[model samples]
Target chain A: MKARVFVTLKNGVLDPQGKAIANALHGLGFAGVGDVRQGKVIDIELAERDEARARATLKEMCEKLLANTVIEKYEIELQA
Target chain B: MKSAVIVFPASNCDRDAATALKQLTGQTPHMVWHRDSELPQVDLVVLPGGFSYGDYLRCGAMASQSAIMRAIKAHADRGGAVLGICNGFQVLTEAHLLPGALMRNANLQFVCRPVALEVNETQSAFTRKYEHGQRVVFPVAHGDGNYFADDETLNRLEGEGRVALRYAPGQNPNGSARDIAGILNQKRNVLGLMPHPERVVDPLLGGTDGIKLFQGLLETLS
Candidate 1:
């Protein structure tokens, strides 16, 4: 099985990198871009195809490494 | 007095911290690797600044979970004095050794420069050399040094006199609350500060304000 983890700064937390990217996009003549937030997607390969177990493991990974709970949150998806 | 400096793989300031300790105490500190399970029996332990674990997952986030931090936690639990500077401070927060977390500067840029800090609390072991409200200069180089905590935590910190240093008037380099530059644990044995005091130790390095901080540690352990 393969899993993907998406980690992003919580809504209320400041996302400096996202803001910088938004500014850069606006400078490049992009129009009507209401908002922009940046996040990371981490892909991992697992030996088992159990989606439930993979999700649990990914949550643990997020708490331990994939995300910083202090400022960011994470979601996981597993694919067969 | 025995002292040790924890060295994570990417810790660029380890040597500077060790030198400051050696010069101040005339006792060379043991350089403990992050992989080690135990720290040397010492009165003081320093977590120096730099991009630990390449600042991945978040500044100091990954480094906080390294093997040595467990030992460091144990040492701190035993009331050993621990001082964390810059990235070290970030790690301490990520390790849950201190309240609050550091976020990117309000300007969304990496700030590297000398900033003035006023001693906010002089009762802690780390600030005994300076009187309350005394000013000192130290260099800060980091993208995330704006400390954040809940209102209750902030109030508790202020009420307990755990705020050890504050950026002086008009020197809000990182936009930290109350221009906070450093804080101590509730017990006052652990200190986490964003300024690079080690960089300001030598008089020829354009400042000597930081020498007093290291000297204060030496005095405490002796």
Candidate 2:
């Protein structure tokens, strides 16, 4: 089994990288780009067969490594 | 007073911190490695700034799980004083030793400059040498130094007077909420700040505004 984790800065937290990207887009002549927020996508290959077990382990991974709970939130997608 | 400086794999400021401690306290600080399960008997423990574990997962995320952190937490539980600077502040937040998180600078640039900070409230042992509302200049050098927290937590911190320092008038280099530059734990023994006070201990190098912070802690040890 494989899993993908998407980590993003929590809402209301400032996103400097996203803001810089938005600025770059505006400088490139792209108009009306309201706002941009950046995120990280991490793919993991697991040895577990049970989805429940995978979700639990992935949650630990997110809390421990994939995401900074202080500033970011994470969502996991399990795939077969 | 005895003190120790925790040295992670990639910590570059451990020496500076150790030097400051030795100069201020007249005793060499124990340079404890990250893997140590125990810290020496000391009055203060400092987590110096640097890219721990090369910031592998996120700033301070990996270092928070290292063997030494468990000891640091235990030490804190026993009421020992702890100070975290720059990357150390990130580790303190990641380890849940302090409230709020340090995010990237609002300008999306690595900020390295001498920022003037107002001594918001100096009731703690960390800032007892300074007067409230006084301005001090120290160097801040970090990418993710913007502090953020929920409104309730922020309110509680303000009410408790745990906010130790704020960017001085017209000088919020990182866009931190409420212009916060440093905070203290509920017990007021632990302090985490984004500025590098150890870097400005001597006037010949640049400034001496940071000397009072270390001196204040020394006074508390007596």
Candidate 3:
């Protein structure tokens, strides 16, 4: 089984990298891009055969280490 | 006073912290590794600045979960004094020992320079030597020094006088809320700040304002 986690800064949190990327896009003449927020995706391979169990484990990982929760939000996707 | 400086793998400021502690207290601090679960008897514990775990996953995230953090938490729980500088400050917040998180500078630049700081709370064990509202200069070097917290938390911190230091008026280097440069925990035993006071302890280093911080700690802890 495999799991993927998408971590993103919360809506109100300032994202400097995202801002920089947005500016760069503007410089390249890509107009009409109102806002850009950058995030990361982490892929993990699990030995657990149960999709439910893998998702549960991934959630724990997100809460404990993957996502800070204070400034970040995470989504978990499990594949069998 | 006895002190210990926790050394995470990528910690670069441990030596400077140890030097500052030894120079002020006349005793070399114990250099405890991150893997150590036990701490020697000490009056203070310092988490020095550095790119711990290469600042991977987030600054201080991995290091906060190290074996030694449990011991550090235990010490802080017992009203033991703990000081965290720069990345150390990030670790404290990540560990939930302090409030708020440090974000990248608003300008997305690595800021490193001497900035004036105003002492907001002199009653804490760490700032007793300075008078409230005193302005001191300390060098801050960090890429992620912007401090962020919700409005309620910020209000609570201000109302409770937990804010220990703030950048002098119009000198906010990293867009920290209320220009906060340092803060104390609810117990006032733990302090986390972004400036590198340890690097400014010697007169030859161009400033000694930072020495008063260590001296204050020694006076209260001893």
Candidate 4:
């Protein structure tokens, strides 16, 4: 089994990279782009066969290292 | 005073820190590796600046989980002095030894220059040699020096005078909130800052504005 984690800056947190990307897009003529926020995706291969157990462990990873809860949030997705 | 400098792989400023300590305190600091778990008894431990773990995941993220951090945390818990400069500052925040996170520079550019900073609170072990409101120029070299925290936490830090240093007005190099250049932990034994004070301890290096910082620590901790 595999799991993917998407980590993004929190709503109130400033995302300078995201803003820079947005500016570059606008300079390149993408006017429709709204406020852009950047994040990262991490994929992990888990040996656990139980979905519940995998989810629990992944959550722990997010809290411990995958994301900095003070400025970022994370979402987990499990795949077959 | 006995001092030790934690040297994580890729820590480029470890030697600079060690030199500063030796020059000021007249004692050679122990160069502790990141893999080591035990710290020889020392009055102060320094987390020097560098791209520890290649700044993977985030600046200082990987190094924060190093085995040596366990002992560093224990030392801080017992009120031992800890000075974290630049990347070390990021590691301290990542380890939850201090509040706030050092995000990418607000300009999305690596900022490396001397910026004027004022000693906001001279009561901590790190800033006691400087007078309150004293202005000094320290070089800051980092990509992720923009400090961020919730309004409540910022307010609490300000209310408690935990902000040890603040960038001189309009001299914010990385857009740190409230122009915070450095902060002290609640116990005031741990200090995390983005500027490189150790890099300027000698007049031949550049300027000697940073010597008082080490001298102050030696005075208080010895």
Off by over 4 Å in 3: none
Tell me the spans in candidate 4 whose CA falls farther than 4 Å from its real position: none
The local lDDT score (0 to 100) that residue B154 gets in candidate 2 is 93
State candidate 1's DockQ: 0.61
Please give, for residues B1-222, the per-residue lDDT of candidate 3 as tens digits: 899999999999999999999999999999999999999999999999999999999999999999999999999999999999999999999999999999889988999999999999987989999999999999999999999999999999999999999999999999998899999999999999999889888999989999999999999899
CAPRI verdict on model 3?
A: high
Best-to-worst TM-score order: 4, 3, 2, 1
In the range B45-110, model 2's lDDT, one tens digit per residue, is 999999999987778988999999999998898899999999999999999999998887888789
For model 1 chain B, the run of ten residues with the poorest summed lDDT: B172-181
User: What are the per-residue Cα lDDT tens digits for candidate 1 across B33-124?
Assistant: 99999888899999999999898868899889989999999988988899999999999999989988898898888999999889999887
Q: For each candidate, what is the lDDT?
A: 0.89, 0.91, 0.94, 0.95
TM-score of each: 0.95, 0.96, 0.99, 0.99
Clash number by candidate, in order: 0, 0, 0, 0
Give per-residue CA lDDT, model 1, range A1-80, as digits (tens). Answer: 99888998888777767888889999999997757889999999998777788788888889887787877888888888
Using lDDT as the measure, name the better of candidate 2 and candidate 3.
3
lDDT of 1: 0.89
Candidate ranking under lDDT, highest first, comes to 4, 3, 2, 1
